[model samples]
Target: MTTLPRSYWCHRDFDGPGRGRLELQSMTTPYPGRAVTWMRESVRDALTGLDRPTFGIAWAWLGNHQASGAAIRELRQGRPYTFTLPAPDGHWTWSAHPVSVLPVIETCANAPSSRQQLVPAHANGDPP
Candidate 1:
Protein backbone atom coordinates (compact mmCIF):
# COMPACT_ATOMS: atom_id res chain seq x y z
CA MET A 1 0.00 0.00 0.00
CA THR A 2 1.17 3.53 -0.77
CA THR A 3 1.79 5.50 2.37
CA LEU A 4 0.37 8.99 2.24
CA PRO A 5 2.13 12.09 3.55
CA ARG A 6 1.06 13.72 6.74
CA SER A 7 -2.43 15.19 6.56
CA TYR A 8 -2.79 13.96 2.96
CA TRP A 9 -5.51 11.49 2.19
CA CYS A 10 -5.98 9.53 -1.01
CA HIS A 11 -9.49 9.28 -2.35
CA ARG A 12 -10.49 6.50 -4.70
CA ASP A 13 -13.45 7.06 -7.02
CA PHE A 14 -14.20 3.32 -7.03
CA ASP A 15 -17.72 2.66 -8.45
CA GLY A 16 -18.64 6.29 -8.66
CA PRO A 17 -19.09 8.11 -11.97
CA GLY A 18 -15.52 9.38 -11.62
CA ARG A 19 -14.02 5.93 -11.50
CA GLY A 20 -10.73 6.65 -13.26
CA ARG A 21 -9.94 9.77 -11.33
CA LEU A 22 -7.26 9.88 -8.62
CA GLU A 23 -7.46 12.53 -5.96
CA LEU A 24 -5.45 13.60 -2.90
CA GLN A 25 -6.75 16.01 -0.31
CA SER A 26 -4.53 17.58 2.33
CA MET A 27 -5.50 19.30 5.54
CA THR A 28 -2.32 21.12 6.60
CA THR A 29 0.87 22.74 5.39
CA PRO A 30 2.04 23.18 1.78
CA TYR A 31 -1.02 24.31 -0.14
CA PRO A 32 -3.31 23.83 2.78
CA GLY A 33 -7.03 23.96 2.04
CA ARG A 34 -6.46 22.99 -1.58
CA ALA A 35 -8.05 19.91 -3.14
CA VAL A 36 -6.58 18.92 -6.50
CA THR A 37 -8.16 16.28 -8.73
CA TRP A 38 -6.34 15.20 -11.85
CA MET A 39 -8.70 14.58 -14.77
CA ARG A 40 -6.76 14.48 -18.04
CA GLU A 41 -4.99 11.26 -18.83
CA SER A 42 -2.16 13.20 -20.41
CA VAL A 43 -1.51 15.27 -17.32
CA ARG A 44 -1.91 12.35 -14.98
CA ASP A 45 0.51 10.41 -17.15
CA ALA A 46 2.98 13.24 -17.22
CA LEU A 47 2.90 13.65 -13.47
CA THR A 48 3.22 9.92 -12.99
CA GLY A 49 6.07 9.91 -15.47
CA LEU A 50 7.90 12.61 -13.58
CA ASP A 51 8.20 10.28 -10.59
CA ARG A 52 5.71 8.67 -8.26
CA PRO A 53 6.97 10.22 -5.04
CA THR A 54 7.74 13.54 -6.66
CA PHE A 55 4.48 13.63 -8.54
CA GLY A 56 2.70 12.58 -5.41
CA ILE A 57 3.84 15.83 -3.92
CA ALA A 58 1.97 17.74 -6.62
CA TRP A 59 -0.92 15.33 -6.96
CA ALA A 60 -3.86 16.68 -4.93
CA TRP A 61 -5.49 19.48 -2.91
CA LEU A 62 -8.08 20.14 -0.21
CA GLY A 63 -10.93 21.11 -2.47
CA ASN A 64 -14.01 23.01 -1.41
CA HIS A 65 -16.79 20.46 -1.71
CA GLN A 66 -19.12 23.13 -3.12
CA ALA A 67 -17.25 23.40 -6.48
CA SER A 68 -17.84 27.10 -7.04
CA GLY A 69 -15.96 30.36 -6.62
CA ALA A 70 -12.74 28.62 -7.62
CA ALA A 71 -10.12 29.42 -10.24
CA ILE A 72 -8.86 27.00 -12.95
CA ARG A 73 -5.36 26.88 -14.39
CA GLU A 74 -2.69 24.61 -15.91
CA LEU A 75 0.62 23.28 -14.55
CA ARG A 76 2.53 24.41 -17.60
CA GLN A 77 -0.08 25.90 -19.88
CA GLY A 78 -0.60 22.71 -21.88
CA ARG A 79 -2.86 19.65 -22.09
CA PRO A 80 -2.62 18.43 -18.48
CA TYR A 81 -5.88 19.37 -16.70
CA THR A 82 -6.55 19.26 -12.97
CA PHE A 83 -9.14 20.27 -10.36
CA THR A 84 -7.92 22.41 -7.47
CA LEU A 85 -9.79 23.70 -4.43
CA PRO A 86 -9.00 26.85 -2.54
CA ALA A 87 -9.79 27.84 1.01
CA PRO A 88 -12.87 29.88 1.82
CA ASP A 89 -10.76 32.94 2.58
CA GLY A 90 -8.71 32.35 -0.60
CA HIS A 91 -5.42 32.62 1.26
CA TRP A 92 -2.58 30.15 1.47
CA THR A 93 -2.49 29.92 5.23
CA TRP A 94 0.40 27.51 4.97
CA SER A 95 2.54 28.68 2.08
CA ALA A 96 3.62 32.02 0.72
CA HIS A 97 2.60 30.89 -2.76
CA PRO A 98 -0.96 29.72 -3.15
CA VAL A 99 -1.78 27.18 -5.85
CA SER A 100 -5.06 28.65 -7.08
CA VAL A 101 -5.51 26.80 -10.33
CA LEU A 102 -8.83 24.95 -10.41
CA PRO A 103 -8.29 22.45 -13.21
CA VAL A 104 -11.19 20.66 -14.91
CA ILE A 105 -10.40 17.08 -15.73
CA GLU A 106 -11.74 15.41 -18.88
CA THR A 107 -14.36 13.54 -16.87
CA CYS A 108 -15.57 16.85 -15.50
CA ALA A 109 -17.23 17.57 -18.84
CA ASN A 110 -19.84 14.97 -17.96
CA ALA A 111 -19.95 15.95 -14.28
CA PRO A 112 -23.02 17.48 -12.76
CA SER A 113 -23.36 21.21 -12.48
CA SER A 114 -21.61 23.04 -9.66
CA ARG A 115 -25.00 24.01 -8.26
CA GLN A 116 -25.97 20.39 -7.80
CA GLN A 117 -25.89 19.24 -4.22
CA LEU A 118 -23.37 16.57 -3.33
CA VAL A 119 -23.56 13.80 -0.82
CA PRO A 120 -22.38 14.98 2.55
CA ALA A 121 -18.93 13.72 3.49
CA HIS A 122 -20.44 11.97 6.50
CA ALA A 123 -22.76 9.90 4.28
CA ASN A 124 -19.96 7.97 2.58
CA GLY A 125 -20.26 5.23 5.20
CA ASP A 126 -17.44 6.64 7.25
CA PRO A 127 -18.04 7.57 10.84
CA PRO A 128 -17.94 11.30 11.49
Candidate 2:
Protein backbone atom coordinates (compact mmCIF):
# COMPACT_ATOMS: atom_id res chain seq x y z
CA MET A 1 0.00 0.00 0.00
CA THR A 2 1.08 3.60 -0.59
CA THR A 3 1.85 5.85 2.32
CA LEU A 4 0.94 9.41 3.09
CA PRO A 5 3.30 12.41 3.30
CA ARG A 6 5.03 11.23 0.17
CA SER A 7 6.37 13.49 -2.58
CA TYR A 8 5.13 13.41 -6.17
CA TRP A 9 6.39 14.56 -9.52
CA CYS A 10 3.50 16.51 -11.03
CA HIS A 11 2.78 16.77 -14.75
CA ARG A 12 0.13 18.08 -17.13
CA ASP A 13 -1.25 17.18 -20.56
CA PHE A 14 -3.19 19.75 -22.53
CA ASP A 15 -6.26 18.46 -24.29
CA GLY A 16 -6.83 21.80 -26.02
CA PRO A 17 -6.25 25.52 -25.67
CA GLY A 18 -8.24 25.72 -22.46
CA ARG A 19 -8.44 22.19 -21.19
CA GLY A 20 -6.08 19.58 -19.82
CA ARG A 21 -5.45 16.96 -17.15
CA LEU A 22 -3.26 16.87 -14.07
CA GLU A 23 -1.40 13.85 -12.81
CA LEU A 24 0.65 13.00 -9.77
CA GLN A 25 3.22 10.27 -10.17
CA SER A 26 4.73 8.83 -7.06
CA MET A 27 8.49 9.37 -6.72
CA THR A 28 9.04 5.79 -5.69
CA THR A 29 11.33 3.62 -7.75
CA PRO A 30 9.72 0.95 -10.01
CA TYR A 31 6.35 2.73 -9.69
CA PRO A 32 4.76 0.71 -6.92
CA GLY A 33 1.27 2.19 -7.27
CA ARG A 34 -1.16 3.84 -9.61
CA ALA A 35 -0.59 7.46 -10.62
CA VAL A 36 -3.18 9.69 -9.00
CA THR A 37 -5.33 11.30 -11.68
CA TRP A 38 -5.89 14.60 -9.97
CA MET A 39 -8.17 16.24 -12.52
CA ARG A 40 -9.35 16.12 -16.11
CA GLU A 41 -10.76 19.23 -17.73
CA SER A 42 -12.44 19.56 -21.06
CA VAL A 43 -13.26 23.28 -20.90
CA ARG A 44 -10.63 24.88 -18.71
CA ASP A 45 -6.91 25.58 -18.90
CA ALA A 46 -4.34 23.25 -17.45
CA LEU A 47 -3.40 23.59 -13.79
CA THR A 48 -0.38 25.73 -12.93
CA GLY A 49 2.98 24.26 -12.03
CA LEU A 50 2.09 21.50 -14.44
CA ASP A 51 3.88 22.78 -17.54
CA ARG A 52 7.04 21.29 -16.08
CA PRO A 53 7.97 18.69 -13.49
CA THR A 54 6.73 20.17 -10.21
CA PHE A 55 7.40 18.93 -6.73
CA GLY A 56 4.30 18.25 -4.63
CA ILE A 57 3.11 16.61 -1.45
CA ALA A 58 0.57 13.82 -1.13
CA TRP A 59 -1.42 12.93 1.93
CA ALA A 60 -4.02 10.20 1.87
CA TRP A 61 -6.30 8.31 4.19
CA LEU A 62 -7.35 4.81 3.27
CA GLY A 63 -10.07 3.02 5.17
CA ASN A 64 -13.13 0.90 4.78
CA HIS A 65 -13.59 0.98 1.01
CA GLN A 66 -12.71 4.55 0.14
CA ALA A 67 -9.69 6.87 -0.12
CA SER A 68 -8.98 10.63 -0.22
CA GLY A 69 -5.95 12.82 -0.87
CA ALA A 70 -4.79 16.47 -0.78
CA ALA A 71 -2.29 18.80 -2.47
CA ILE A 72 -2.01 22.57 -3.04
CA ARG A 73 -5.06 24.47 -4.27
CA GLU A 74 -5.57 25.47 -7.89
CA LEU A 75 -4.10 28.71 -9.21
CA ARG A 76 -6.27 31.82 -9.46
CA GLN A 77 -5.50 35.24 -10.87
CA GLY A 78 -7.71 36.88 -8.29
CA ARG A 79 -7.29 36.67 -4.57
CA PRO A 80 -9.34 33.96 -2.91
CA TYR A 81 -10.17 33.45 0.73
CA THR A 82 -8.11 30.63 2.19
CA PHE A 83 -7.94 28.68 5.44
CA THR A 84 -4.90 28.40 7.66
CA LEU A 85 -2.75 25.38 8.42
CA PRO A 86 -1.03 25.90 11.74
CA ALA A 87 2.65 25.18 11.74
CA PRO A 88 4.52 23.56 14.62
CA ASP A 89 6.81 26.56 15.04
CA GLY A 90 4.06 28.62 16.73
CA HIS A 91 3.97 30.92 13.73
CA TRP A 92 0.56 31.25 12.13
CA THR A 93 0.57 29.98 8.56
CA TRP A 94 -1.89 29.93 5.70
CA SER A 95 -2.69 27.40 2.97
CA ALA A 96 -5.10 27.34 0.09
CA HIS A 97 -7.91 24.96 0.91
CA PRO A 98 -8.99 22.56 -1.80
CA VAL A 99 -12.18 23.68 -3.53
CA SER A 100 -13.70 20.26 -3.01
CA VAL A 101 -12.23 17.99 -0.42
CA LEU A 102 -15.05 15.42 -0.72
CA PRO A 103 -13.01 13.72 -3.41
CA VAL A 104 -10.24 16.34 -3.69
CA ILE A 105 -10.70 18.46 -6.78
CA GLU A 106 -10.28 22.10 -7.85
CA THR A 107 -11.59 24.28 -10.66
CA CYS A 108 -8.45 26.38 -11.07
CA ALA A 109 -4.82 25.57 -11.75
CA ASN A 110 -2.28 24.60 -9.13
CA ALA A 111 0.48 27.16 -8.72
CA PRO A 112 4.11 26.32 -8.16
CA SER A 113 5.64 26.46 -4.70
CA SER A 114 5.69 29.75 -2.83
CA ARG A 115 9.31 30.28 -3.75
CA GLN A 116 8.25 30.50 -7.36
CA GLN A 117 5.19 32.71 -6.83
CA LEU A 118 5.05 36.45 -7.45
CA VAL A 119 2.88 37.19 -4.44
CA PRO A 120 3.79 36.88 -0.80
CA ALA A 121 4.67 33.35 0.23
CA HIS A 122 2.73 30.92 2.40
CA ALA A 123 4.33 28.69 5.00
CA ASN A 124 3.88 25.55 2.97
CA GLY A 125 4.94 26.94 -0.45
CA ASP A 126 1.35 27.76 -1.34
CA PRO A 127 0.74 30.86 -3.41
CA PRO A 128 -1.12 33.60 -1.59
- The best candidate by TM-score is 1
Q: Write the per-residue lDDT of candidate 1 for residues 2-118, one digit (tens) a residue.
A: 533322221212232433453532222222233233222223444533444435443543223332123223222222223432322221111112333433468865878864256
Clashing pairs in 2: 18-44, 74-109, 75-109, 114-125
Writing each residue's lDDT as its tens digit, candidate 2 over 32-104 gives: 1222232212101222433222111111111211322222222222122222222222211112221211233
Segments of candidate 1 deviating more than 4 angstroms = 1-41, 61-69, 73-128
Q: How many clashes in each candidate?
A: 9, 4
Q: What range of 10 consecutive residues in model 1 has the weakest lDDT sum?
A: 88-97
Clashing pairs for model 1 are: 34-61, 34-62, 35-61, 35-62, 35-63, 36-61, 71-102, 72-102, 82-103
lDDT of 1 at 19: 30
